[model samples]
Target: MLQIYNTLSRSKQLFKPIVPGKVKMYVCGMTVYDFCHIGHARVMIVFDMVVRWLRASGYEVIYVRNITDIDDKIINRAIENGEPISALTKRFIDAMHADSDELGLMHPDQEPRATDYIAKMQGMIGKLIENELAYQADDGDVNFAVRLFPNYGSLSGKSLDELNAGERVVISGGKRDPLDFALWKSAKPEEPVDTRWKSPWGEGRPGWHIECSAMSCELLGEHFDIHGGGADLQFPHHENEIAQSEGALYGKDRKLEDAPFVNYWMHNGHIRVNEEKMSKSLGNFFLIRDVLKSFDPEVLRFFMLKAHYRSPINYSDAQLEEARAGLVRLYTALAQVTLSQAVKAELTDLQNPWVMRFTQAMNDDFNTPEAIAVLFDLASEVNRTQGDEKLVLASTLQSLGGVLNFLQRDPTSFLQSGTKDEEGLCPAMIDEQIAARVAAKNAKDFAQADSIRKALLAQGIVLEDKPGGITEWRRA
Candidate 1:
């Protein structure tokens, strides 16, 4: 049985789906105003890993990651670029998909966009207003009454007093309480006409928090198994989601325990750079495509899994190079053996020790680092064994890696891809250099052979001289 770390409970608990053998999960996805950064990649890949593992454990999973296509950011970017909101959002949405594909992410079962659910959001807001949990302010904005919801800060583990103390004083905008947040935002006169929708609160758009509440409940039902996003969203965004969703479901008479909105809350940690959080203001933030220019997509995926999902991962060229080398070693082991039909047929035996260990690690809160350790162990065994036994070990390695969406490529293709370095020597050129070195060694020109090795190593290429005078190389 799998145990997951529920952020709401602040501890690991046994995972029990609301429906037996089925899981319905909602994750807050990208706000598509620009290209996805490494932070966004972590959310997509982390949840992708979770959904994959759940299905692998024999549960049917309905994974929905919503897209925020109609947000303030989108509107502003569109206005700045003098394009329609649809045009701006579509470009980034397509870019997101391309980035996801490059990172080997599986498409969510349902990707609900915010614009399509305006009617549902309006209906939700109206219910809250009728129940007196929400009110239309003098500015025409509808705001959720945080004071009426007693458990408003439960998700973030902060009391209302604490939140209020931390909040900056600003014009209340007709809100009865300072902590109250928008359910619907009244449109500004300068905003595009298409961005506004006719609602009970006048022509305006749904607030960011309300969009997820409406979409998640409408698609996944009033309650679901899991709700997840980055650690940054735990406060304000997800906390508000909890208050709004549950408040809407139970009305003014609602207690915190009246009904559960999400059984488990999970959050993946942030991506840091040089021990500082990666952000645009700091100038250390990296776009997915920018990183892909120097490393293979799978290398980036492998780098992420190398750390526990809940722990902060630092991004550096050296760290990525290390991940690349690790991948090369795993693929190298696969290259030495053939997974014949006979060997592959035997891979269905889940009772195999290596598979059992991998499953155990994954079951313990998706401990991918431990699971990957098992792959390295299996790879070692493959290198040490021979004939049919080696083939079996290699097949097991591939099968276990497939569970985590790794190592399914042809080993040769992966090894020769050369880390996507545009200016670096190609695989064929490296091979030619290796051939020349081999010839130089055979002709007794030891100095020439040494010079070739040093030249290649200078370009971040590492060459390994194996038994029987065989030479192999990989990007360092």
Candidate 2:
């Protein structure tokens, strides 16, 4: 049985789909005001791997990640750029798809947009209002009453008595409590785009939280298998979603016995740059495009998989280089295995131990880093054996490794694609220069060669020359 870590229960659980072979999952998607970033990529690719593994294990998965196309952030960004909100949002959505595809994340089973589900949003809010789960304010805004839902803090583990609304919260009159969130917002008279709809209350737009609840329920169902997002969403965003979705389920006429929202919850940890949480104030935030321009997108994806999904991944130039090298090694190692001589399309018994190890590690809760370690071990073993003796096993190893999506390329081609440009100080190149300098020393052109190697050393490559006229180089 496949096992997965569920944030809701705070434990690793056997993953038996509620509908047997079918999986219904909803993940919070991009806010669409800015270009996607590495932070966004982590959640995308993590869930992508989850789906990949599930499918590989024989489960049919239906994944939905909703795009929050309309939000305060989008409106403000559009105004600043002097462009229509729709144009700005469309640009971002397209950019998101480009970067996401570049990183090799499979598109979600359904990519729901908030703007497309306005009517469903209104109907859900109407239900909340009718059930006393929501209320309308004097200013034509609707807010979910915090005190009305006894399970309000179940997701975030905070009580109404302790939680306070801050920056992301909107100030409004209809709210009975400060902690209550908007279900609908009254459009500003000069708000550029028509961020309003003719609701029973008046012409206004749906709030951020309601969009996910309405859209996910409308597309996926009233209750789904899993809901996932960044760790940051554990607060008001996801917490409120659980409240609304769960409340709707509990209030169902059918009186379902299970939790109303989701049977599972998965969260990825934060990402940091220079040991600091990436933030606008620090001037260190990197867009996904920006990083992709500097390094292979797979390098970033590999770097992410290097750490457990639940651990904060600290990123730096050194770390990226390490990830690049590590990936190249795995790729190269797999490529070195000879498989063409196989008489039949059969996997060797040698493939079993590694598969069991990899499966056990992953089944322990998608331990990718650990599973990759198992892969490296298997690669080493594969390298130790060659020829037809390892043929069938080698093919099986190659095929299964390909399923991980990180081991398809030949290590040599992937590394020597001439991806190394003047950018990214490569230590291997630096070392080669050092070896050249050593060669100059052997030729007694000490001064010239010393200068040459010194110039190379400054660039961070190290070289070692053997007495037998052999040289090996590595990045310093």
Candidate 3:
């Protein structure tokens, strides 16, 4: 069984899908105006782990994450780049996919684009207007009438009064209330490009909130199991989604059963860097690609899991180094165990406890940090033991490995990849150096041989002298 923190209920609930054995989870996706930052990394990998665990435990998850390629930012970016909106959005989506794959995320079952669902959005707008939940203003903008929806601010825990208090946009002449948000915005007469569509009211582009409401309704259903996004979006974007979805999904009678919309809401906390909020305006943001260039992708994934998903992760070079050392420790233990030709290694009934314990920790709440500690403990035991069956030991390590999403390949591969630069070479390069050291020792210059060994060690390489003066080395 799995447990998830449902922000709607403000409690951790036993995650029994509304339809047993199936989960319909919708995670809000990228805006596509820029590269995904480490903040986006937290959300991408955290849910990847969540989806992986649910699938591993025998549940069918239809995960739907949308790509928001149509909006102010995208339009502004296209204009700034002197390219079409299609070109700009496509370039970023490619970058986003590269970053996502590098982090080892499982692809969502459905990835809907906002631009594809304009018709569905128009339909929903028609329903809202008919129900008196929304109306067109004198300026040709259709706005959701916040005063008409009693549950308008429930999801964000903010009241209509609070929203009105901090309102920044121009309160259009005909808008009934200050809290009303735009469902569609008319293209200004003075604007250079007209990106609007022909709605019943006028030609206008769909608002940010309308796209999610319509896309989710069309892709999943009138109701889904979970709606997830960043904590920052909890207030206006999500609250607006609830209002718009609920308004159209039901009839005049307003029975809750008619429009079940979403049962659970989940929000992952923000990511900070070096105890400060990372922002592009602050010039403190790091792109996912830039970070990946220097660090192993799995190291980044492991770093994300170090803190709970609901807590803010502080991104820093120190944290990266710490994650690297932790990875080294894990792969080192895995390298020592040897697997046999048998698919299932020999395990006595008495020694089958550790992997079980690790699974228990993971199932509790996808508690990766705890599961990782369990892994290190198991690795330490395997490293300390003598006369143990190598096959059984390797199998034991493999068992815990899947849960961490680590140690899947040969441990030597991991160690080799990570230490190549530090070693100033790879296996082939080390072999060349070994021949030089051998020639020196052959000349009876033991001092030169010692010098070569010290040089390799300085590069984090360890050499072992073997039978007949042959030598092989691996990273220590």
Candidate 4:
């Protein structure tokens, strides 16, 4: 009983998979021309959260996030770097995986590269041509006839007239209509030879829109449960995907086009930095690896989840520091319990009131911000109690966090591993300082003990002196 905000429907609806207990989802993944930015990171984390929740709800999920390994950007970057397209794409794909690993992302069940599905794309394009939904342009490129598809702008909620008026589509010389998009692009003489595939429409490559249509249909059938991507893709990319997929493949007679292409469409919002869109032209673009340099990977993940997936998240040092502090507070509560108990414990009692509330929040459109509030409340309870109740509360906190792939680290290690500061105190140094402070307090040198506490505080570390002279320290 989960309600999801479907972009196509423009409202929250109950999620019902095509198959009873199975979910087949396709998310448009990274276009590997360069390192993934914070925008790309949001797409990665948002869908990851979705997949985690779906599986936790007892559904078998086959998540497929496609990689655009062969795109115009990839080709241009390869040419600029004076390397083969394969070499350029390989480096970026590896970098993307490293970032994914650091962010604790689950690998998609199938990551189909666009290059491998050229035959499928060609087949779909040929079918469209046969149905008269597509035509080969005078320039040897095949373009989808948008006018023939009556529901072309349904996903984006814009009519052909509205799209034509608002959109500034550059009219290609051979295109019959400005709004028509290419299904197959004829190769250019200057482009890489390997980038071109021999198709019925001469030596060219699949257009950006057709790639997803072909790959998703080939892997997940003509229709699937969910299709997700960034909001920017809603207009031409996803709208065109719906057009081509349904225009050629779906429906009984193909002309009526009555079948749905994708059941639910989910789009994660954009990432803005300091109230502006994150872009290279604006000088606020941050690569995922670069942000991971300053903040812990968990901190970055938490930052993205702090806001609802559909809401635009503001990225700044202050926001990240706040996220870091909030995550530290959650981990600090877990640190109160023994590491073995915290890690090994499971939520056997789903009927617990807190669990019920958490499930309610998560079921309502993956309301992570609300679900996370339950964690904070649980942590507060864990900190105030002891013995059996505290054990249960702490275990519940860890179990709930694990549903979102959070709170899996050893609490002590997680608390101590602060941000990457070259001049800041390391764990050994902090421990040495704490030992000195403890020794001074034991020897009745109150002034020296006070001095050590003040010094550590000035270095962005907080110390809590517990009974029996145990001092716990964490980055402030």
TM-score versus the correct structure, for each prediction: 0.93, 0.86, 0.89, 0.96
User: What lDDT score is found at residue 239 in candidate 1?
Assistant: 87
The better-scoring model by lDDT among 3 and 4 is 4
lDDT of 3 at 269: 75
Deviation of model 4 at 73, angstroms: 1.5
Stretches of model 3 off by over 4 angstroms after superposition: 163-175, 190-194, 251-259, 340-352, 386-390, 419-423, 435-450, 462-476
RMSD of 1: 2.4
Candidate 4: clashing pairs of residues: none
| Residue 148 of model 3, lDDT score | 86
| Ranked candidates, highest TM-score first | 4, 1, 3, 2
What shift in Å separates residue 212 of candidate 2 from its native position after superposition? Answer: 0.6
lDDT of 3 by residue, 1-476 (tens): 46777777787787778788888889889999899998888888888887877776778999999999888777787778778777888999999999999877778999999989999999999999889899898888899888788776777667777774232234777677877888888886633353567778877788888889999989889888988888877877888898889988663346654645788788887878768877776889889888888888888888888777788888887898798788778777766656544245222232567756666666666777787887788778777875555546656776666655666767767766652124257678777888889899889988998999999898878886767776756665
Ranking 1 against 3 by lDDT, winner: 1
Lowest lDDT sum, 10 consecutive residues, model 4, at 250-259
Q: Write the per-residue lDDT of candidate 1 for residues 365-396, one digit (tens) a residue.
A: 99999999999999999999998888888988
Clashing pairs in 3: none
lDDT score, candidate 1, position 67: 98
> In every candidate, how many clashes are there?
0, 5, 0, 0
Of candidate 1, the 10-residue stretch with the lowest lDDT total is 164-173
- The Cα local distance difference test for each model comes to 0.88, 0.76, 0.78, 0.88
lDDT of 4 by residue, 1-476 (tens): 79999999899999999999999999999999999999999999999999999998889999999999887778888999999999988899999999999898999999999999999999999889988889898998898888888778888888888886123234688788888988899999999898998876799898888999999999999889999999888988899899889888752254543558899999998899878878777888999999888888899999999899999998898999899888888999998887565444443456688888888899999999999999999999999999978887888889899898899898878877878754789888999999999899889999999999999999988898888868888877
